[model samples]
Target: MRAEPSLPRHHLPPDRLAELVRGEGGPETLDLLLGGERSRRLLLLRMLDDATDLGPAWDLLSEAQRRAPQVVDDLLMYPQTGMWLTTALRRLRGRTPMDEPPLWVELGHMSALAAAALRAEFDFTIEVPVRHGRVPLPTLGCAVLPETEPWTRATVRAEGGRAVIEAAGAEVALPPTTGSAGPGWHPVRRLTVGARGRRLDIVLDDVDPYRTYPQPTEPRPLSGEAAAQWRRMLEQAWELLLREQPKTAEAMRRGVFSLTPTPAGERFRPRSVSAGDAFGGVEASEPDDAVQLAVTLVHEFQHTKLGGLLHLTPLLTHDSDRGKELWYAPWRNDPRPLEGLLQGIYAFVGITRFWREHRRAAPAQTAMAHFEFALWRAHVATAMEQVHRHPRLTPLGTALLDTLRDHCAQWLAEPVPEEPLALAHLCADDHVARWRAHHRRPAALRPSTGPYGHGWTGRADRPAPWRPNPRSCPTPRHAGWTAWRCSSATASAARTTTGSRSTGPRRPQPGSAER
Candidate 1:
């Protein structure tokens, strides 16, 4: 039998939802989201069980739940567990074959979760599959076995408060669950920081296979020095957030669960990603400073909050007329769908708020903070308008946009430094010009569904950022960017209905925008 919706019905008060959409939600909001996510986890487990034999995985989980309910619940909420079950079910249903990991390895994640939970409570033995001779216990670390095959089962037995793992007839005692991995064992490390008498424990999870989103990945376990570096940076970032951005800090404490560090990138501009499938999981390149790391957490947690909201209520659906429509996203080099625009808006709202608060918090950082806040508020404001009148937007989506509209209006009214604001205007104008060359068809031409038809047929005059009187014209001038069709399709106008205005200063860069 399949599991059904467990909560009476998941809901958020409109006022609370508005607060959440505006990126302020306390434990009450997070609790509802966590419960909703729990139901989803149970539903996926039932679906996987119905589709394929979960073997002893289910029984082990039940036993673990009996022994340590909180441990079982915590492991279930691990980002990778959600990722693994979601992919496993997709594969079992014969969908996304190329995108998902192998079914055998995917199913093995169940045993991994169960082992960690059961091993936490009872001195029990179980067998979990190993990949490339390394058995990964999700939320824990990987256990590398001797004489391992490409794929084989490892027996893990925990007794007398100690554990030993064996594969291919050779056994090794597990290393203590702190510091570095032993000669043949690697354990996941934890980072803990506290403020106001409450502790925040975050898993520095570089050893889980499902740590990466959309698919399981080979563990790029951080070396000792690298791991130590991550811990130091995280502690600093946490302290920064706690001291300067308490609301965001409390939110992160309530939501963010794990950090999976990618290879280091540029000193200042590190890359990061968050997936809807993995709530509370953040993957980021190593950062150069606590500020860089703090901002990344602030930005990614926006995606996390919105991702959680989406699981409870869909904000939009495919338009019957346009099917799957794509529109211009100011932040990107290409066109995006309405959903993407919403995600960006929600994230940037949080980002904009972060910089706004940072500017006020640290006097030395005000200049850079002002520019970021200005640039993002403009992008977010325009993006909000781009989807403001979208037909397919649901009521929940509308409310979200409306909340953003109110917030952006307040931001636009606030004064910004002239130098940074001017640069922000320039960047904003450059982006629109690039978008035009890439996607606009001459307005003279009738709307087309032609292959390669995203051009304006006639004279096209677009909006420029209101540099003259920004207070009066807060909505930046954006040209009527046409709907983009990658494979020769219909052209729908997005910002077309808004009247034309003065174009910004033009700098003719060589290359055309991406088609």
Candidate 2:
């Protein structure tokens, strides 16, 4: 009998898992999460190959693995590759319909990863597909071939030691080592924020075909002015986290790998999301200022951490999402699954923790900060009550829910200002009434065929008004909307403990808006 190859195994001790349950962990925890992702990618590749004939793409990847292992690891580690690999496998297994990119282009992604690796470390000859005159190299960037027509393949032949993209009769230069690729190559933009001795590196990923998960959009790279603005805002936002919440800031630096910039929606609202499938990625609309930007980073990063944690071990004994309507989450307009409910509670713990510090850390912004803290603290505690003792929860789930509840419990002793507390209460009551109206069936009011109080009032027959679904269009987001919009330049704010500078209440800039 032939011996099968063995795979690597990862084990997390009980204490380390406990730290993550409390919504707190250090480098070791993050490393475990990300390290697990690599193993997942390897398994995905093996399955994908067995399910379909990957052909030369598989051969290219095998060669690259043998000749340039480091480059192979680096390219596979890029987060968007995770999204692509999962979606491609789903397509192969008939879990999802074969859609627009077509199965061929999807398989071509493996070739793209292989090509990028070989380009970085070895001289290799390969042919990569060009869809609508664009060659997308997974991590590097997309090479636009204006000179070539539709549905073609670009040949990458080594000119001496360098790999160049050539299609039709023209050669497309890769993003430069020393200079810009000019207009032909739109490279993925990597931006960084540094404070004290620590730094966070993230890609503003506008070039990948698979970057969009929940809702896909066209690849729209930022204009020169817009890219510059993103750099400025990110630096300012990173500074705020480093100053007020260093530990959370460190957590972000450890995990968050990329942000896919979504177009801005209506004023007073900003949108952001992260998913369990895409562990280290976030999709967000540009916020009004640095503080709002900082909050979005925290909100998305919390989801990222939880997503990674769920991958490590099972929380529920059975599927929690066979029907999501069973669980009610205050932060969402729609009901969540038990797992989804838990995700919301974990994220709000971080958000509430941010505002709890902000109210005292920057006394000038106290009222708004107090409002956020009060609102989220109530909502999280409420959700925790529903899911904390779920019958389906394994002991791991129970531990996580209890640790989070205890953290929220500690915040109960902190007092908010009278005015903000009143406002928070009013908002909470208003949402409860609306949610009941939206979901609960009220008695149907009869026509005036009879006198008042004489008419029969059966259960209300009609459904609630339809709001925009995220699966279709951009709707006004209620979750992070309140935290991001400064709404005006006049709302001046104070500095942090170290006395560095960033935006307070941001005014709309001449050319800036979310999009």
Candidate 3:
């Protein structure tokens, strides 16, 4: 057998190498080792792979941080790992430019995710090693752990750089941090405030409470009036949202709807969001957050109440043949009731009302305005077709359908020139397209596909209609037949074409018998 070639020395297992480096025995153990850059790169990649397969690597980083805060510095200076380090730092602390010192460069390379996670756990910044040549260090402005105060008050003690928080018969251990051992206090320079209904909660980070709002002015550090103003704003926004709930609820029932509360600060932060019956959650961006939250709540709610009813219910399950087809369709196949269709129309009406009420003072119209119009047109078209095809409509059903059509027509006639152009065109186009697609399908025949080609097959022994006349029913505006009509025409044509006969009326329009 040929002698096996010697394995490359750098190909050592990552865990074993990491252990040597952590123990400060790596360089001495491997004489062939060149620089820290190569070793660090290999180590970091190993860590990353471990993180991907096991869980977030933050836990390992935290343990490393405790063992040696300088470990981060070493990794940052390590050439191969430096890029990822820089990426992580930027993600955590925001981007820092190159003109900054080498220390800043190393600091900038820190992972944002790591920082956020660590910040929640400890108060420590990695120090750059001076031996690695002149590297700049960026000063992280005053930052404090949000959980520190509560942890301290609860007689938190740290073991092996990990903190143990005991409160109300509950004991929780927290990892150790540089700050927890030092003054254990930082100034409160910023506040995160959120308001829900009448309740407003303020979180002060690295700030003195006596200086913040809800406290007497003299003892505080920052401008007391500013803090008080912020409190007032939070309260005002909360009140405004609560006051609008009734109208919001009504609007939501029509279509997708949402509500977002404003955050407490000069910059508008969204405090909370509620979306239809499906989903709603908070976001960090201040200005867009409030608007998006409100819109989501309203929009989703509309889907639940109005959109839900107009379509077929129990939405075909995955096992159903139609359900499989629905998966490929862009739109969901949730069932909707006639009442839901009306509700969607009403939602559009409500939107019009809302615009009239707030137009002059309102901010720019949101995308929701256009969305509502689209939903209204769809609901109206579906309802109209349903009414037309109901062989014998109930008195109430007929009245409702007629009323909705009249309302739609009135809306169409409105002098708001811009309003009619977009929606009317879309409605008309969609109506025609829907009819053509559905009416021409072979599966749409009334009884079944086998016996009929285009017209009805009345009975086995009896004759059926020969050719359907255009005059049999009024011409569809979009030239499409309803489901029932489509089925009838299909059966009749198929029966006549397949050698079956019909005794029904003859063709009416000139082209009725052609093709």
Candidate 4:
């Protein structure tokens, strides 16, 4: 039996110590520790003396698995170290033998080594306590392990050439096997698992070796049958808009209008998840006039086509802002600012088009009901910065930019309504009041004091960060203005026949604009 080593007096934070024990320490430290021929013996002695509790030791093992699971196999080289771990597991399980092969292999080997070394010093048998519980292990199988104990049991089911395991109130199914078989192992196959819950259903797949979850399906272009219907609807909408609004029609002919499809299985409303690009192929279930859907499609398509010249790039940047790295930038140059602006413009355009097409089918009040104005405003500001950077616009580009700016300005200028809903609500009275209070500042402080910080007059006409006061205004005048503008010249005639004055200010009634 090996003699127990003296404990070190050095102190380390729990997490840091866990990292060191897991071999995540820098190379200098690891190499030094492993340099000598008797390094293994030294390590075993040190670990036995240093590990005060099983928690830290368990953490060390877990971190080793996380950093490099293969390192756990290396522990076998130190017979005493392995025995210590096995003994620890047995103690955790109250001395009950582990029922699962994987668990046994993981714990038994380590404990056996520790027990062998301690046998000379202590004659009593050690019993480990285990707490029974189940957990969902994706792709492999469900396992029932003692939460407090190391002993565990697992029953895996084979269905549809996949392995199914249930644990932690989840059902996990592994992918079908593939590739040539070796003496004891086979090539890894694609693993897929689905967890059904009372309120949610989650599906995960392993397409990459690192076990990235929720793998995306390949982008599917419109099928022949679907393509025909899509084209027909687009053409009909285009023709109708062209005949009704010649300017809008001209914009369409000049390739100012764009179309894109959202990818399959993506949610547009209620919630959104990170998957493919923000916008891609359209979904079949999407409403033809869904403002959000239209905005996403048109915005993304614009990024694909005239993005270079317009400086409206996609939002897929590879910068390490938060958790991302610089390698994710889509273009050589940072195109996020330009893409953001385009996304905002496209969102507005899509919403406008939807309103125009479905005015009769859906009320104008309901338009832009679900849009978030603050987010859109931020996008507009981003685009405006790009435009300011490149102020000189071609005749065609100037016209398009002018139109977009005018639309955005009109929305901004209109009085924000009280308790407005959707992006348009930003133009409503109550919202304008809130915007003003929130944006209030001394007049001496130029527009730079607003959210945009840079003055609007600088370079390009960027959006002012100051939101209109919602309190000063009681109702949105823009919607009324738009309605009045769209009305026929005979509006006065109708007013006269109805014996009602047409000059009174209009107020948005409660719940009149819900989407």
Maximum-TM-score candidate: 2
lDDT over C-alpha atoms for residue 231 of model 3: 43
**Predicted structure 3: clash tally:** 66
Write down the RMSD of all candidates, one decimal each.
9.7, 6.9, 25.3, 21.3
lDDT of 2: 0.69
For residue 2, what is the lDDT in candidate 2?
Answer: 83
> Which runs in model 1 stand beyond 4 Å of their true positions?
1-7, 99-101, 147-149, 176-180, 196-198, 318-323, 440-461, 464-515
Off by over 4 Å in 4: 1-162, 166-342, 360-433, 443-515
**Candidate 3 segments exceeding 4 Å error:** 1-295, 299-409, 418-424, 431-515
Ranking by TM-score: 2, 1, 4, 3
Ten-residue region with minimum lDDT total, candidate 2? 506-515
Backbone clash tally for model 4? 51
lDDT of each: 0.70, 0.69, 0.31, 0.31
Backbone clash count for every predicted candidate, in the order shown? 17, 4, 66, 51
| lDDT score of residue 97 within candidate 3 | 40
Please say which candidate is ahead in TM-score: 1 or 2: 2
lDDT of 2 by residue, 1-515 (tens): 98988855777777778778988776778888888888887888888888888887788778877887877887777777778888888788788885667677777877777777755565678888787888877767777776445566788765556657887777776644622555578777888779546898888888777787754343567777787788898999898888899888887787888888877755445677776677788877777778878878887788888788787787878753455335546666554566677777887788788888877887656656776788778778877876687777889889888988888888876776665666565555445444444443433474433222222232142222222111221233334322232222112222322143433442211111111
**Clashes in predicted model 1:** 17
Q: What local lDDT score does residue 256 receive in model 4, on the 0 to 100 scale?
A: 24
lDDT of 4 by residue, 1-515 (tens): 99899854333344532322221223232223223212333454356435433333344344444554444433332222323333434445567353443443344323222322221222222212121443222121122333453344333343333444343344434334332222222222221111221111111211111121112121122334554444444444444444444433333232221122332232222111211111111222322333333333333333322322222212233433422211101111121233343333443344343333433342332222222332234234334434532333344444455556656565555442223223232233233233333333425555535543443234355333321121122223222232222122123322433454333111111111111
